[model samples]
Structure formats: C-alpha cells, structure tokens
Target chain A: GAGVSQSPSNKVTEKGKDVELRCDPISGHTALYWYRQSLGQGLEFLIYFQGNSAPDKSGLPSDRFSAERTGGSVSTLTIQRTQQEDSAVYLCASSLFPRGPNEQFFGPGTRLTVL
Target chain B: QQPVQSPQAVILREGEDAVINCSSSKALYSVHWYRQKHGEAPVFLMILLKGGEQMRHEKISASFNEKKQQSSLYLTASQLSYSGTYFCGTEGFSGAGSYQLTFGKGTKLSVIP
Candidate 1:
C-alpha cells in the first residue's frame, strides 16, 4: 500500500466481545503506532513498535489492550472483553523510524462501537 | 503523561490569527504539531526541536521551549481549510533510540469565512 491501511473501518459489537484491529504500514516504514481517539477527545497513544527495539507498551490504558508488530511491517491491536466505554476510533500510523526527527503518516482509522 | 491545552476551542475568520498552546509537566525533547479535520486522520504540521528554535510548515509554524516543556502552534492568515483539531505531541526524552509521542488534549479550531 502507498500509505498505512487499516481493516474493518468500522466495527460494532456487544460488551464483553473481543475485537481485533489490523494495520499494514507503508512498505518500508519501520515504526508503527496505535492510538485511540474517543468522542471529542485528542489522540491517545496506546503502543509503539520500532525495528530491533523492544516495543513500548507504557501508553496502553490497561492490560486488556495488546499489540504486536511482525517483522517490523504489519501489526495488530487486540482489545479483549470490550466495554461500552471502549468505543472509540482506533488509529494506526507509521514512520521511517524517528531517527533524529520525522513525522508520522497516519491511517484513516477504525471506528469501534461497543454496545 | 498528558499535556494541558488551552483555549479548549477557537473560532476564527479567514485571514485571522490563532494560537494554541500545549504545556507538559515533564521535560520535553521536542514538540510536534498536527491537524485533524472532522472524520479524517491527523496531518503533520511541523516539529520544534530543543533550543527554542521554531519549525515551519507552509503557513503553519510551531515553537518549543525545552526549559518550560511547553509548545505553541501559530496559525497566521488562516484559511477555511485550517478548521480542525490541532494537537501537540511531545517527546519526553531523546537518546539512543528513545522515541514516544504523548499528545495533548487538543484544541478545536473552527475557521469561518
């Protein structure tokens, strides 16, 4: 893909149901990021991955959230046992490693609805 | 850590100027600016590195002061297309491959012509 792509642009599920979001970064991007934006809120950082570097999971709000980037290319964010408060737009972004300084290219994002 | 954003929201007429501020509690390595319109993803504006230097991207510009851990985005002669939420992503530390982006609450800007 020419840019970062996400699957299932929108998802609706009942509380307690699990959801998996996928992200395919740009072909050569080595750093991927996952963020969540609630209604009328700013982008919340969830996790980040960089080639050869241990993934940073500090930004994740809770243990129910987990993510993994395979071969520094593709990544997935899994939210377990969703709750009504979990509804938000999940955004994925990629960049060529923020070496000295660089910008992140973001995807359109997936809107998750928890009933 | 979350930075505090001021002027929660702003409404401006085309060609007017606006300022959005992001203040962090922790020391900042750099501050990044991004614009996100309704229903769309964020678009990078520019990043202000340490040393109080300013970074400019087109008509949008930003400045960061490592000492105060604060950043501000300046929009001069705004256009209707400039209406959107502006965010500041701050990096606390920088060294051997340490990069993490912490965004502020955001300021919603509505430009009315």
Candidate 2:
C-alpha cells in the first residue's frame, strides 16, 4: 500500500513569497496532521483534520500559516509571506482514526528553504 | 506541552542495550514512539496508552508509567540498523474534543559494530 506522501520533496523561496506544500494521506485514513521540524528540533504540530469536523489550527504558528484538506484525503499547507524562520521540513502524517492509540504514518516531508 | 526526552544522544555497540525516556509535566493519554534515519520520514515503532500498557516490537520494547507521565523505550542487543533519531510524541487533552501530538527534540542513537 502507498504510504503518506508529500510533493516537491524540496522547495526554495524568497522571503515574502508564498508557498504551498501538499500531502496525500494513506487510503481510508480518517485523520491527517501537519507538523514542522526545524533543524535539529522536535516536530512542531501545525494543523489537524479528522473526517469532516472543523480543522484544528491551534498549532499554526502565525496567521500566515494555514491548511485545508479536501475530500478527506489530500491536504495542502500554505505559508503566506514566507519568512526565513519558516525554513524547515514540513511533515505530514495520517492515521486510521483521530482518537484512540492509533499510530500516525509519516511522509518523506517537503523541505522548504526561505532565503 | 512537548514531552522532554533524556540524553539527547546516545552511542552504543552492536550488541549493547539502550533505553530512551520521554517525560511530560502534563497528564498524558498516550505516548507514541518513532525512529527516523537521516533524510527520511519517521517510522512508527510503538504506542503506549495511558493505562500503563507495555508494548514490544522485534527487539524493541516500551513501557508507559501513566502515573508519572513518562515512557521508556528499550532496545535490546542493538543492531547497526537501530541507528537513528528516536522521537516520542505525546497526546494529551487540550480542549473540547481535540487531539494532537507534541513531539520531543529526539534522541539520536548511534550503533556501531
């Protein structure tokens, strides 16, 4: 079975530019999450989508960050007016369900560099 | 809050054993473990629920101490393939029906033959 996958394995953008990172979750997985890992840092939660419920955007660092999951499968994270601080590996993960002790499967991630 | 992992890094011999710990100040509902090799996605290892259940995968095992909000991952007879950064992601109650994982900085384990 295909695992969670992210597109554009690498991306480089200038400050003030806007960039979008895409994620395709595993088939039939009802929950999806987005996280950011700064160099040598832990995974920072960004956003979460479960089924059709309202997305959880609490982890988003700033207003410039946002995400949307369409058809309960593909998710896109958009960072507006990219900042150097946003340079990090954006990771996407999916699981069968949101509650319980399900393990999230991660994608290869898209490494974004903001100059 | 993010869980805190101890001994940010560790080096072990191929036949040695090692333990990695993750602790949180807040009450935890579950602890998830993952291993990531260089330039790769993190791979799930195991999950320990709040009931203090222990889990084992291959030569790796984990224990959760729900009372203390801590979990430990044990790798026995470490193999060279065990080398990677181990991350512990914690899930706790935030608010009305919300669940998200907060991961630690990670413990880099190096296994040499």
Candidate 3:
C-alpha cells in the first residue's frame, strides 16, 4: 500500500511569500495531522483534521498559518507571509481513527526554507 | 504540554542495550513511539494505551506507566539499524473531545558496530 506522501520535497522561498505544502494521507485513514520540525527540535503539532469534524487549529502558531483537508483525503498547509522562522520540515501523518490507540503513518515531509 | 525525553542522546555498541524515557506533566491517554533516520520520515515503533500495557516489536519494547504519566522504550541487543532519533508522542484529552499528540524533544541513539 502507498504510504503518506508530500509534494515538493524541498521548497525555498523569500520572506513575506506564501507557500503551500501538500499531503496525501493513506487511503481510508480518517485522521490527518500536520506537524513542523525545526532544526534539532521535536515535532510540533500544527493542526489536525478528523473525518468531517471541525479541524483543530489550536496548534497553528499564528493567524498566517492555515490548513484544509479536501474531501477528507488530501490536505494543504498554507503559510502566508512566510518568515525566516518558518523554515522547517513540515510533516504530515494519518491514522485510521481519531481518538483511539492507532499508529500514525508519516510522509517524507516537505523541507521549506524561507530566506 | 509536551512531554520531556531523557538522555537527549545515547551511544551504544551493536550488542548493547539502551533505554529511553519520556515523562509528562499532565495525565496521558496514550504514548506513541517512533524512530526517524536522518533525512527520512518517522516510522512508528509502538503505542501503549492508558491501561499501562506493555508492547514489544522485535527486540524493541515499550512500557507505559499511566500512574506516573511516563513511558519507557527498551531496545535490546541494539543493532546498527537502530541508530536514529527516537521520539515519544503523548496524547491527552483536550476540550471538545479533541486529541492530538505532543512529542518530546527526542533521543538520538547511535548504535556502533
């Protein structure tokens, strides 16, 4: 089976620009999550989408960060007015369910660099 | 809050054993373990629920101590392939029936042959 995948494995952009990172979760997985990993740091939860319920945007660092899962399978994370602080690896994960004991499958991630 | 991982980094011989620990300040619903090699995606190792269950995958095992709000990952006879950063993700109940994982800083394990 195909694992979770992200597009544009690498992205380098100027500050104040907007960048959109895409994620394709595993088929049939109802739970999707977006995370960010800064250099030598742990994974930081950004947002979550479970089935048709409202997405959890609590982890979004600022108003400029947003995400939407379309048709419950693909998710796009958009960072408006990117800054140097936004340079990090963006990871996407999916699980079979939302609230139970389930393992999340991760994608290769998109390395975004804001200059 | 995010969990805290101990021994930020460790080095072991191929035949040695190692243990990584994760602790949280808040009550935990589950603890998830993952290993990530450099420049690659993180791979799930195991998950332990709130019941304080222990799980094993190959020579890798984990124990969740619900009462203590902590978890430990045990790797026996460490192989070179085990050289990677191990992370513990903690999940707890938020408001509105929401749940998400908060990962620790991670433990970097280097298994030398």
Candidate 4:
C-alpha cells in the first residue's frame, strides 16, 4: 500500500510570499494531521481533520496559516505572507481513526525555505 | 502542552540496553512512540494507553505511568538498526471532543557494533 505522500519535496520562497504544501493520505484513512519540524526542534501540530467533522486549527501558529482537506483524502496547507520563521519541514500524517492508540503514518515532508 | 524528553541524545553498543523517557506536565491519556532515520518518515514503534498497560514490539517495549504522567521506552539488546531519533507524542483532554498530539523534541540514539 502506498504511504502518505507529499508533493514538491522542497520549496524556496521569498519573504511575504505565499506557499502551499500538499499531502495525500493513505487510502481509507479517516483522520489526517499536519505538523511542522523546525531545526533542532520537535514536531509541532498544525491542523487536524477527522472524517467530516470541523477541522482543528488550534496548533496553527498564526492567522497566516490554514489548511483544508477535500474528499477526506488530500490536504493542503497554505501559509500566506511567508516569513523566515516559517522555514521548516512541513509533515503530514494519517491514521484509521480520530482517537485511540492508532499510530499516524507520516509522509516524507516538504522542506520549505523562506529567504 | 508538549512533553519533555530526557537525554537529548544517547550512544550505545550492540547487546546493550537503553531507556528513553518522556514526561508531561499535564495528565495524559495516551503516549505514542516513533523512530525516524535521516531523510525518512517516522516509523511507529508502539503506543501505551493510560491503563498502565505495557506494550512491546520485537526488542522494544514501552510502559506508561498515568499517575506520574510519564512514559518510558525500553530497548533490549540494542541493534545498529535502532539508531535513529525517537519521538514521543502525547494526547490529553482539552475540553474539546477532538484529540491532537503534542510531540516532544526527539531523542537521538546511536548504536554501534
């Protein structure tokens, strides 16, 4: 089976520009999540989508960050007016369900660099 | 809140045992463990629920202490393949129905033959 996949493994953008990162979750996965890994830092939760319920955006650092999952499979994270601080690896993951001991399968991630 | 991982890094020799710990300031419902090699996605190791249930995966095992809000990953007879960064994700109640995980700064483990 294909694991979670991310597009444009690397991206470079200028400050104040907008960038979008895409993720394709595993088949039949009902839950999807987004996270960011900064240099020498841990993964920070960004957003979550479970089935058709409202997505959780609590982890989004600022208003410039947002995400949407369509058809319960593909998710896109958009950062408006990118800042140098946004330079990090954006990761996507998926699982069978919303809660429980389910392990989230991660993607290779997109390394974004803002100059 | 993000959990705290002890010993940011560790080095071990084959056949030796090692322990990695994750502690949270707030009560936790479950803890998830993962291992990732350079330039690869994180691979799931195991998950320990709040009931004090201990789970094992091959040579790896984990224990969750609900009272202390801590989890420990135990690796027996470490192998060179075990070299990677280990991350612990924690889930807690936030008054909302949804559950999201907060990950800790990973612990890098290097095992040599």
Candidate 5:
C-alpha cells in the first residue's frame, strides 16, 4: 500500500517569498493533516481536512498561512511572505477516516528554509 | 496544551527496560505513541483510548490513565532497533465534532548493545 507522499523534500526561499508544499495522501484516505516541526520544539499542528468539510485552520499561525485539500485526496499548504521563523519541516499525514484512535501514516516531509 | 514528557532523553543497554511518561493538564480523549529514527517519518506504535485501555505492540506497551490525564510507554528488554525518539500525542475534543492532537517534546531513547 502506498503511503502518504509530499513533494519538494527541501525548499529554500528568501524572506518575503511565497512557497507551496504539496501532500498526496494514501489512496482512499479521507482525512489529511499538515504539521510543522521545528528544532527542539515539538510538532505543531497546522491544518486538517476531513473529506469536504471545512478545514481546521485554528492552528495556522497567521493570515499568511492557508491550505486547501482538493477533491478529497491532495492538499497544498501555502505560506505567503515567508519568514525566518517559518523555517522548519512541514509534514503531512493521513488516516483512513475522520475518527480518533486511528493510525496516521506520515510522509517524508518538506524542509523549508527561509533565508 | 502540549503534554509534558519526562526524562527528555534516556540511554539503556540492549536488554534493559525503560519507561517514558506523558502528562497533560487538560482532559484527553486518546493517547497516541509514535517512534521515529533520525531522518525518518514517524511510525505509529499504538493508541490508548479514554477507558484506560492498555495496548501493546511487540515489546512496547502503553497505558492510559484517563482520570490522571497521563499515559506511560513501557519498553521491556529494549532492543537496538528501539533507538529513536518517542512522542506521545494527546487528542482532545474542541467543540462540536473536532478533535486535535497535541504532542509532547518527545523522549529520545538510545539503545546501546
């Protein structure tokens, strides 16, 4: 079975630049989540999408962050005007359903570096 | 809030045993444990629900204490393959039907043969 996959394993951009991270969840998975992991600090929840329902955006740090899951399969996390603080690994995960106690398969992650 | 993990790091012999604990200030619905080696994706180990159910995977087992808002992961006769970072993720219900996970800083376990 194919696991979740993310594109651009590493991204380097200058400050004030915009970048897009892509995530392809496992086949038949209806729930996708985006998280950021910084050094020393633990993983931080960004956004989550379950099927066609409204995505959970509470974890997005500011207005510059946004995500969209298209057709219930793939998701794209966009950060506008990248800041140095945004330098971290962006991870994507997916579960079979939108329920608790389910295993979430994670992708390789995209490490973003803002210079 | 993020759960607090004790003993930020641990080192043990291949045949030794170790325990990692995670405590949360808020009530929890479930506890999920994951292990990840350097430069690898996190792999789910097990999940314990709110009923204090204890789940086991190989030599790894976890217990959830709903009343105390705590969970513990026990590694018995640890193996070299067990060397990695252990993360405990606590899921709490927001309002309506939303549930999100807050992960601890993680416990780094090193197994020496």
Candidate 6:
C-alpha cells in the first residue's frame, strides 16, 4: 500500500459485543502506532510496534483492550465488552524509521460507535 | 498531558488569515501540526525541532519555541480547501522517551467563501 490502511471505515456494535480493527502499514515502514480519540478529546496513545520486538503496550486502556502485530506488517486491535464510552475514532500510523521521532503517515481511521 | 489550544473554533472568509495557539506545561523538544477534515484522518503538516525553526507548507505555517513549550499555527490567506480541524502535537524530547506526541483537542476552522 502507498500509505497506512485500516479496515472497516466505520463499525457500529452493541455494548456487549467485541470488535477488531486491522491495520496494514505501508511497505518497508518499521514503526506502527495506534491511537483513539473520543469526541472532542485529544488523541490517546494506545500502542506501538517496532519491527519484531515486543510491542510497547503501555498505553492500552484496560484488560479488555489488547493488540498484536504479526509479520512486522499488519496489526490488529481488539476491544471486548465494548462500552458506550469506548466509542471513538481509532487511528493507525506508520513511520519508516526504527527509532522514529520522525514523521508518521496515518490511515483514514475507523470510527466505532458502541450502542 | 494534553496540549492547550485556544479559541476552540474559528470562522473565516476565503483569503482571510487565522492563528491557532498550543501551549504545554512541560518543556517541549519538538512540535508537529496536523489538519483533519470531517470524518477523515489527520494529515501531517510540519514539524519544528527543539531549536527555533519555522516550517511552512504551501499556505500553512508553524513555529515552535522549545523554551516556552508553545507553538503557533498560521493559515495565511486561507482558502475554502483549508476548512478543517487543526491540531498541535507536542513532544518533550527526541530520544529514549517516546517521540510520540501529546495532541491538543483541536481548533475547528471554517473557511467560508
């Protein structure tokens, strides 16, 4: 892909359901990141991956929130027992540098609505 | 901590100019700017490093003052295509600590023709 791409531009789910969001980063990029933004709120860092190393999962909000990156390319974020408060836009970004303090390219984002 | 952005929102006629401010309590080493249209992901604009550096892209411009941990975004002679939400993302340092940004809530701008 030319840029970072995420699946399902929008997802609407019941409060008790689980949802999975996928991200396929641009080829050759070594760093990936996930973030969530509630309505009118600043972005919240969720996770980060650098190549094949153990992902930096420090930002995951709760036990119900988890993510994994396989093959150093595609990643998935899963949220279980979705709460209304979980409704937000989930964004994925990728960068070319391993030690990326560099610019990141973003995906269109997946807007999740928990009803 | 989240960066502080002023005015929350703004409206302007095409060709007008506007400024958005972002402030942080912690010392900043770098700042980035992004713009997002409704229902879309943010697009990277420009970055200013710890030292004074002004960066511009087309009609959009930004400045960062590391000492004060503040940044300003300028939309000069705005166009209808410029209508969007602008965000200021602040970072504390370049190494060890994550370079990930702490973003402002955003400033919504409407460029009316």
Model 2, range A1-115, lDDT digits (tens) per residue? 9999999899999999999999999999999989999977889988888874545778899999988888988999999999999999999999998755788899999999999
User: What would the TM-score be for candidate 1 when compared with the true structure?
Assistant: 0.93
**lDDT (10s digit) by residue, model 2, range B1-113:** 88999989999999999999999998888999999999999999998887756899999999999889999999999999999999998888777466667899999999998
Error of 3 at A109 (Å): 0.2
Looking at model 3, residue B44 earns an lDDT score of: 95
TM-score of 2: 0.96
Alpha-carbon runs more than 4 Å astray in model 1: A52-54, A98-100, B94-97
Docking class of 6: medium
Tens-digit lDDT string for candidate 6 (B53-75): 69999988888877778899989
In candidate 3, stretches whose alpha carbon ends up further than 4 angstroms from where it belongs are none
- The residue pairs that clash in candidate 1, if any, are none
Q: lDDT tens string, model 4, B1-113?
A: 88999879999999999999999998888999999898888899888888857999999999999999999999999999999999999988765665668899999999999
What value does the lDDT take at residue A7 in candidate 6? 92
Question: Each candidate's iRMS in angstroms?
Answer: 2.3, 1.5, 1.4, 1.3, 1.4, 2.1
Q: Rate the local accuracy (lDDT) of all candidates.
A: 0.85, 0.91, 0.92, 0.90, 0.91, 0.86
Alpha-carbon shift of residue A105 in model 5 (angstroms): 0.7
Model 5 chain B lDDT-worst window of ten: B94-103
Off by over 4 Å in 2: none
Give the distance in Å from residue A88's predicted Cα in candidate 5 to where it truly belongs.
0.2
Q: Chain A TM-scores, all candidates?
A: 0.93, 0.95, 0.96, 0.96, 0.96, 0.94
TM (B chain), model 1: 0.91
Arranged by DockQ, best first: 4, 3, 2, 5, 1, 6
